[model samples]
Target chain A: PQNNKSVHCHHPCKNIHVFQKVAGIVIGKSDVKSFPDRKNIGVDRFTFSFTVKDSPDFFINVTAWGNDGYINLLSGSFSVGDCVVIENPLVATKDPEKGERFCPTTPSHYRLLVTEAHSQVYLCADIDTMDRLLPLIHLPVKDSRDFYSLGDIVANGQKLDGTVINVLAAVKSIGEPKQFTTSDRRKGQRLEVKLFDDSVSSLPLVCWDREAIQLVQTLIPKETVLFIADVKISFDSFRNSMAATVNSKTIITVNPDTREASLLFSYAKEASESGALDQDEKPEDAKTIINIVMFLDSITDVYTVTQLKEKAQENPEAFFGITYSFISKLDLDSSVSKVIRTRCTRCKLQVMEETQSCPNQLCPGRDQAFSASTGFDLLVDFTDHTGTVHGCALRSPMAEQALGCTTNEFTMLTDDQRTAMKWKFLLERCKIYVKILPSTKMRTGIRGVILACTRADPGEVKQHMSALLQRL
Target chain B: RQTQETLTKKPAVENSLRILTAVIDGMRHWSQFKDKVPYLFEIFATLDSAVTVGRHGAKNFLMRDGKEVVQCVFYENEQELPRLIRGQVHRCVGNYDRSTDVLVCVSVRPGLPSELRNAQEAVKACDAEMRVLVKSISEV
Candidate 1:
């Protein structure tokens, strides 16, 4: 029998094997975590985990265990997104309580364990020769001390809309990075870090570059002060405010050894101690808040449609949230045109003029006969006390659930029957889960899809409102 | 024996339309009967379906399962057509053309193969509705 391991692992769980060497790009690295050893009482044990992926679909969690100094040294040697090679590691089955509690959920059934005596980690030395490999961020533009206060940027928001400037501020909070695929199937990631200074309470600084997101991922919220040099300033007309973008010309210095940065850092620590900073919005606080509410499993960060609009404008990253609103407009009673569309089974594109091939020029099955299925494509309006959102997409299978019928059944209903069905949801309050996307081309300034739509339970609504009030 | 009756009536195309609905809508797959209805059918095992609109605006498609392949034809009732999901078993209900073995659809929708045994009423209702549509098309 051949003993060679295949690139596609059949099932890593079946056998425990020692990997001589494995190389992958580090996607995430966590801070060094320590716990008091239960068996040793007086002694402490330290461990840190990082995730590496050789391909887009597969990534494995690797943890190193050693004394405080050794674990710190190993973790600090490589930043996220670096191509790193692990030598002589044991592949062990994962413990759900220990592994998944802190680390990301992975498809691999087993994780790599790195120990002090048996394993070593190295940054791939061959990376430079492979120039096509992801590029390292340029070193923070060699110590330019000049910077702008958050207050200054806001005061001159219009004038600095298109200019480059340095900003010095303490991290108020950092949001989880949002990963999305563009229409062309290209992957993109965005992270938003909220910054605050003595002059300004809060300003969103966005990180769109991959390396930039990884760098900001390591910063401790409210403890680290950033000196961002040559960052682009853009005036957001949607929010009627200003925001900064980190780009190629920008270099971020974490905890810069400067008098101003040090001063802001101390101020941040003081503000956090005094309870002046609102910590409720942070994901870390969600666990305790969840325990108190007890019914928060289905709900996440609830917002009124008006607040929802502001939230989308505040950060470029996409987010999911629930809103209580009325179905102000549902076009079921109108002409039954375009409500049901035939999509080419091969490419899933709309077939316009009844061709026998996919409309997509590059579709794999373009030369084959075109097969299509019809489904509901609906546009609806959601209104709350704050405001109304126009043209929110309510598409199939969710649309089928809300209307209580299949596409075949819907087409059979007369206009009067459709109108009667529409009236049932038209003015009634509904609890709608929506995925909001900041859209520039839309007249409403924001676009969204209704993930779920159903009638709101009055008692549940009251209870949810009280929870929000208690938090406030 | 049943295919012979269908062949004889194939020449009276206008009569089939005038009597539709009942004549075509009530028509079942030949495999389903020992007696002849107004039409014939060819059932396929694998699903290879396509819907195309011709120059005069008639929409048609082919249904092919590996065991056999059959054609279905229609016109203007695009809204009435069920969205055929790929990879699911589907059937076309139309009078069979013995010469071409085409299922000129009368638009009857059968419940999926799994549900067909229990969905006789739903199928009956569907056949009635499509019969009206075919009758109107013939008048046009």
Candidate 2:
């Protein structure tokens, strides 16, 4: 008592001894209460409570406030279970009974400077920030809000939604024709596929189209990026987990959206890891895209030189050369020409002539589009047993070679390899179809030509065209 | 630039921690530890409003600078304690009735040591109840 001296300063606790700092060990802490109050000095006090293990049977009262001018500096993101260390504690007290003498308690008069703030403290409230808050490990949102109704749970049907999420797996079976069953109980074609990821290697993907199914026969799991958007998930008969059911409505293919593109890029990287890449240095279906090319055949009609010219009216570069010459010979009405267009996949420049460079130097995707002098006069659309159609054009020597071919030869697509060749040579508009092609040499020695004007499916067109294709 | 901005800002919990720690450390009469201070106590109490206990009660808490805290009630009991005092700070000095037993504690936080409040609550519970009067040392 003799050594006690009254001192005045900005804070009450600043004059206290060093040994009096800090109470219990930094152990488990919890929130008991938090509220707002105003001090007699016209300052606001936002009170908070914390429970500690070692010291103090009574709860610690902490007022969360600063001077009036600095109130805006506080963060609103604080939450429960956040472990915080306080520096420079202060305290104050008051009379418990109305008529009782006014008394002060040492513990109540304190100010603590908060040191470290962790975002994990608010993890429960902000599910969206998990990636930014959590470090190192990759965590996918398993709260069912992000899932696209497609695919199944990797683990057996455990808790449908929980924090302990580990694997996000989807069905990857190549559909087998034997498994194809329509809602009417009619059997169609199916392709079986296996699910795969770089994390776990590979699985199966089931494609229902005959050409796609046939192509899947030779496809390695590593070389495909399946974007099953509206795939509805159903409980298996065993009720072990939810699985994907592909009907005619299932769009089990890659799309151009960022999410789907990212999936494919990763898938391609995974395929490359498994030696799925060919000598040609082409990216395995699942590889990241270094570049992209976008061309429109027709919004309403199958793409043709006339449609391309109309679409390409903005730039002569995409239309003038081979596609233009072909359009000039055809007795196409101007209305048809306006329906389709071709432009640089990179710069969207309308290509005009067969040249190595575009008129706009910055325009990429610039290359000799087919050839200028040599133009294809014949257009053939081929449809397979599965109802998917693909179209191709033949000109000069190739058309002459096919002029005398029989219908059987012209429409022959006996295997998946042939389907892939037609797709590789004639079907550049579709990336997903190219990714599903079978990996075999059967298509290396094939060609087809048709004299009759019959429309066919794009998927079948890929199968019928057997020509040892010029480089695409 | 961000670091500079952060360094200039004052902390949020400076007031409560300062008041709590100062009284706990100043108290010297407890049989459990050396001197009158036998044991150490740290209590965490949260009232709905900072003024839930009123200006007199807050000032009284500040007056006990170094004494063992007995019980701390954070929740309100309107039926138990009626006619609570209105908590006010930074008003004109002449308006306050300092001559009487009731005096509003308007002192700013004295900036005390932090660890004093860190004293265990269990230690404070073990102490004898000593009534420490709350009185204004200065007009401000």
Candidate 3:
């Protein structure tokens, strides 16, 4: 049995067996370059180099269209004397005469294609040649200072890529005429961007039309790391390097759809150090329950978000908390367990809990029930303000029965008891007002109300609260 | 009147004219009363801006500032009605309680009669269109 120990991995590589069958490693690096094809193919031979542990140094030849526009992208003038970590590169065969070739392992002539390369171009030593680059491993870039003098692309004779950049600009409303012109003249158009940062000087950044334009438009603000790919920056008409414009063919994209927080987990390190037996075993069910507890605890602890605006600002974290709780609860009960009690697929009648055979006579779904949990019966019980209920949750005909002469008639009742549990529980802890909606699935003449809870600003708890409330 | 007669037509030109007429009617009512009275046009538009144009025209009233808005009906649709408009940049013509089905008149705007005719036509077309979508569905 082949194990991952055989391959020397510098970066996180999971499911090594899955990659074994793959011909070439699907790389996430953006070391694309376009140069004029002086050797004859009428296209520039683009070279992209990346590295992997135990695997031979790999390079990919990219054919970039060389127009007067790609002149900036073609000029690879960065001084490369820095140590770098090239991820998951595979050695691919290449020929000076041929456009494409198959992957061969017998010391064939090939170019090195790097996957997800992380590098600082001007580090302590010159590590470009693959032979001399074996021993030294580059460290992670920590701050803005670490990128200083990391000579790669000289934007106006200076390093302009590693700036702590922040931009506040509206979606540029470009007319159809200008939109048409980019496809006609440059093969890519530009957006007039107004950029800003805490730095003393700001300038227009003429971004190549490929990736950067999309990045500027789609990227949600407050992203920790910006993975920019295939973009060439020129001083814009405003002469501000910060005021950038994206041209066509210049691609600006990132590794992940990075809107939310990205928490990297090193499970390999955990499993290796903690013990493989623990890793191999299914996780304990309490893990999810504990997460739910933690989420509820976090929301209760938040005292600062008193106003709706403040609460709305904290809504993301609040929703994240709710999500973690709900997901944890969901994880506790597998789908198989949920279907322990079945219902009829057609008439929607309750069947046996273990087997989905309905006991109802003359019912279409009788003796052909699906699952107990599959039955659309709602169970609601009135709970005190503390969210602890007084009576047990009902099922069947009893669950469908309405309330009889209660002091809290105004308290809303929902169709689903679990949904009510979540709402009432949250409402009890906070000032959120919720009204349960009537369900068509529910039997007629049944009125349900779990309890009364005050209303909070909808905008504040809106994200965390289930959309079910809206439907109700 | 000519525009109102062509409300059910699918031509973009007619549609735009009908929409414009509805807006003009809503604007007229919007300009009339000083006490911020809620008009019938505003009430219908509050329920569904794109529903029956007659209803929408009736519902299509305005608040003080000019951006278009209608009352959010949570009770009828079983949806959560937005209580407070997040930003105060725009004014609301009416406030609706999803549970109580109560509509409170917040502001007023007088509109032109020509716009009312346009709104009426647009609404009639919308109702007919809904009937078509509903007619196509076969019950299981």
Instruction: Name the top TM-score candidate.
Output: 1
Candidate 1 lDDT, A1-472, residue by residue in tens: 1122233443342222434577766755666768888778888889888776654345678888888888988977988657887887666766786566556556687777888888889988885522432432212233445788887777654456578888888898888776655557656677899888877667789987665787898889989888887688874422224688876545576776667778888899998888777754454223222221222233366776667888887887656678866676788877665677667764567776466666687554444456676667788887653357789877665577678887889889988688778756765557887768899898656898776688866554545445544543
* lDDT by residue for model 2 (A220-322), tens: 4444444443333432211112344433222232322246446655766655665643332343222211111111111112222222323333332211111
Q: Which candidate number maximizes DockQ? A: 3
Error of 2 at A204 (Å): 19
Clash list (residue pairs), candidate 1 = B40-B96, B45-B65, B46-B65, B46-B66
C-alpha lDDT of all candidate models, in order: 0.63, 0.28, 0.28
Q: Comparing to the true complex, what docking class would candidate 2 get?
A: incorrect
**Rank order (by TM-score, best first):** 1, 3, 2
TM-score of each: 0.32, 0.18, 0.21
lDDT of 3 at B75: 31
CA error at residue B13 for candidate 1, angstroms: 68
Where does the lowest 10-residue lDDT sum fall in candidate 1 chain A?
A: A287-296
- Prediction 3 global C-alpha lDDT: 0.28
TM-score of 3: 0.21
Which runs in model 2 stand beyond 4 Å of their true positions?
A1-137, A142-274, A277-343, A348-354, A361-472, B1-140
Best candidate according to lDDT: 1
